[model samples]
Target: MTSNPPIPMRPIRTAQSRFPWHHFSMRFSSTPRGARLARRLAGERLDAWGVPYGSDTHDTVTLIVAELSANAVSHGLVPGRDFRLRLSAEGTTLRVEVTDTRGEKVPALVEPSDNLDGGGEGGRGLLLVAALADRWGWYPCADGPGKTVWAVCSASVLAAPSP
Candidate 1:
């Protein structure tokens, strides 16, 4: 059998094969459980895309997306509104994007404050996201409220085994 066989997918806004988008998305209640579900579902979807459960690609992507989703629930929460998680694997790039309805809470990569202790109640989530992601950033919604915190983990991450 050929290694790294092509993954099939439908066109999204005229998305092409080279731009092949293997995607899954869900809207979840703005709660802790919803954040957890986002993470689990991401792992499952990646598995369906040939990223093995314990593979580095799976674990890294799952963890980063989970942390970001959790932040969405904790900080960007809006009453009655849910958060969304979208995963897309194209060629050698995997993109994870999480959007919440709260427009005011602009996600940022905070600098570790002097008061920031190795042991603290908050502040580690995005730090971990930064460390794990090959490239990460956030952008304001072009046509509406809220922002999307997205991260891209390089395909080479899969070249290694999960620790």
Candidate 2:
């Protein structure tokens, strides 16, 4: 009888492990007020999700959300069309996705050429998003109405365990 050593057992990493998609979708008017509501409601939503207000993850996600939603209102607003926002947690990853009705005008990483968008301002929105997100990106909305701006956050409240 021949006996073989047991095979080494290592965990396999899957995309699902990195981003579990729990969805919260709502439509808001394409206005400055909508943008403000997006940021405010993000805090409320996070609290309901067990992330609590003022927690590191909550704050990070909220800021990213504000920037994205602001961009939606400013650059992607379409008459009579509202914008949508969704937030979900996949394991230790927090995902923020904002959709707006301007598919032709896609977002990109822009370099700030000057410090003069205004006093004490300029090129800071996306800058903050880039700094806070572990991996951030966007894609055309599959529904064909607009584009989706997304960012992933490493949850400060509950980190994903090592595989």
Candidate 3:
């Protein structure tokens, strides 16, 4: 009989294990007011998470939430349905998710062109989201209708996790 050596097991290190995990979610009407609320609520939650109200992290996350929510209202709105906003924090990363009942209207990234109109602000919402978020993407909602657009912002530009 041959005996096999025991395999060493490594500990799984996750943000949940290193720091307190925070999450917030709310459903809002698919209207302009809802987009505004999403942005405001995200900022409030980040403040509660100890990021401070006017810190860079807070500002970036707020902008991401605003842009994503606005996109949902303008492009993904489905009559009689509401949109959802979710925020989660783990370790040095904060994530934002906006879900609307229009799975067919998935967001696409547009290349930056010299002729783009922004006047130094940004060409569009997704463009601002792309510039601000360390990472961003979209996926079909698990429960029922629509898709979820998500963004992640890191504590610092250098601290962004590799793709």
TM-score for every candidate vs. truth?
A: 0.79, 0.76, 0.77
Worst 10 residues of 1 by lDDT: 10-19
**Candidate 2, residue 29: lDDT:** 94
Whose lDDT is greatest here?
A: 1
- Candidate achieving higher lDDT, 1 or 3: 1
Order of the predicted models by lDDT, top scorer first: 1, 3, 2
lDDT of model 1 at position 154: 70
lDDT of 3 by residue, 16-127 (tens): 3322577889999889999998888788776666666766666788888989988889889989899999998776677899999999877997754666565543438888
Per-residue C-alpha lDDT of model 2 across residues 1-163, encoded as one tens digit per residue: 9995642333424534643444567889999999999899888766655565766767888899999999899889999999999988666678888999899987777776576755635456777788888877878888787898888887443333434
Could you tell me the lDDT of residue 98 within candidate 1?
Answer: 93
- Candidate 1 lDDT by residue in tens digits, 1-163: 6795554533322212223557778898899999999898888788767677886777899999889999999999889989899999886678999998777887777765666557456777899988988889998888788989999887555444223
TM-score of 1: 0.79
lDDT of 1: 0.79
Clashing pairs in 1: none
Candidate 2 runs further than 4 Å off: 1-22, 113-122, 155-163
Q: State each model's C-alpha RMSD to the native.
A: 7.6, 12.7, 12.7
